[model samples]
Target: MTIAIRMPPDVQSVQIGEQAVVFIDDFLTEPTEMVEAACQSQFSPCPGYEQGKGYPGLRATAPSEYSLRLVELLEPLIKINFQVPEQLDLNKSACEFSLTTVAPDRLGVMQRTPHFDSSSPYHMAVLLYLCGPEHGGTGFYRHKATGFQRITSENLQTYSDVYSDELHRAPPKPRYFDDSDDHFQFLGMMPARFNRLVVYPGSLLHSACINPGIGVCADPRRGRLTVNTFFDS
Candidate 1:
């Protein structure tokens, strides 16, 4: 099967906290191929996100071609919007289709809070929602203690120190984090829509706002299936 992205992707720009977020609708000419591919692949527990920390879900490999074309098509926009270098190496990127399969009982304390992927300014995250609004959307947050909207190397230590102190005082509950809490404040949520693509900095404090009522469904066609890619230099 052939894959193609929409020409001059219907891009919209927005700010989530201090990060530049790009939302593209009708991103692919054949998005169902991605869903079909996910339906066919075997999924496994989402392993350690950082330093062997458990993530709340299941994940499977995605089509490499999708990753390649996505970056190629968004090159100019990414440079201007994300404020990155002109050269983006797809070889340095990653692609995956993940399903939010964790139940509250199975969630880890760390997985219940918002997280930044890396401290590097160059790192970026691109996600394509393959489900309906009922599945939920992605949210940006602010660390209430540190007032950190986007954690950078200069403030990573400060953020970490404050977060560690809070973690011990009161561990996060075993459930998907929604709006606000004592530690993190939700800035806003980018609603998930079928075939909608969203991108933001990896340093932004963010989390998936998984719907509690839907529980967990492994079926890609029915659950919160998403294409998550880390695009960087």
Candidate 2:
């Protein structure tokens, strides 16, 4: 399942609020090799959005060679489609192997909601799904109150104020955020597929659609395994 470099990698775009989310199938020639490599690597708890205890699982930094290769292969398309300038800094970018393990009920309020990687529109996140569909995919969200589908520096304060108020007024259920709720509306999900790669602006509101049926597991082979990478200008 190898999608050739073909300049920018073959892509299918899904427009979400003026943003183009590019998804590609058959992204890796040897995805299993990468999976096995990750399984044998060291992993630790990934810091969360607020309280230093957010992500439900463990993570390990991806090999530098692998990150360099991906940046080399995807930069041209990112520059053109995302309109990033030539001086886009790779220093802000990172690549990591992640696995979701914490149960839905064990999650914090922050983990139960959607999040943006950065406030800058120039920040892009490239996610490679190394597991099967049973593991679930990523879902984009829109704030019901502010009607904000994208979170930027300009709207951050406004969105956060309204969101915080709503949470205090009426708390959300302690469960995974895969569907619509009182605050955020579920727009759609990019279904997970083995060796599938998708890239989108990190500013967009998004959450991992952790399948409650599968629960939590630390094993990379049995759990949800993903290659998370970020780039910003």
Q: Give the best candidate by lDDT.
A: 1
lDDT for each of the candidates? Answer: 0.82, 0.81
Candidate 1 lDDT at 10 equals 79
- In candidate 2, stretches whose alpha carbon ends up further than 4 angstroms from where it belongs are 1-8, 48-52, 90-92
Report lDDT (Cα) of residue 220, candidate 2: 82
Span of ten consecutive residues with least summed lDDT in model 2: 1-10
- lDDT minimum window of 10 residues, candidate 1: 47-56
Indicate the residue-level lDDT of 137 in model 2. Answer: 93
**Count of clashing pairs, candidate 1:** 0
lDDT tens readout by residue for model 1, 1-233: 56698887778988776667889998889999999999988888776643326556789988878877876876666778876766655334667888877677667777889999988887778899999899889989999988998989899999999998888899988878878998999999999999999988888999899887773777899888998887666
Best by TM-score: 1
Per-prediction backbone clash count: 0, 0
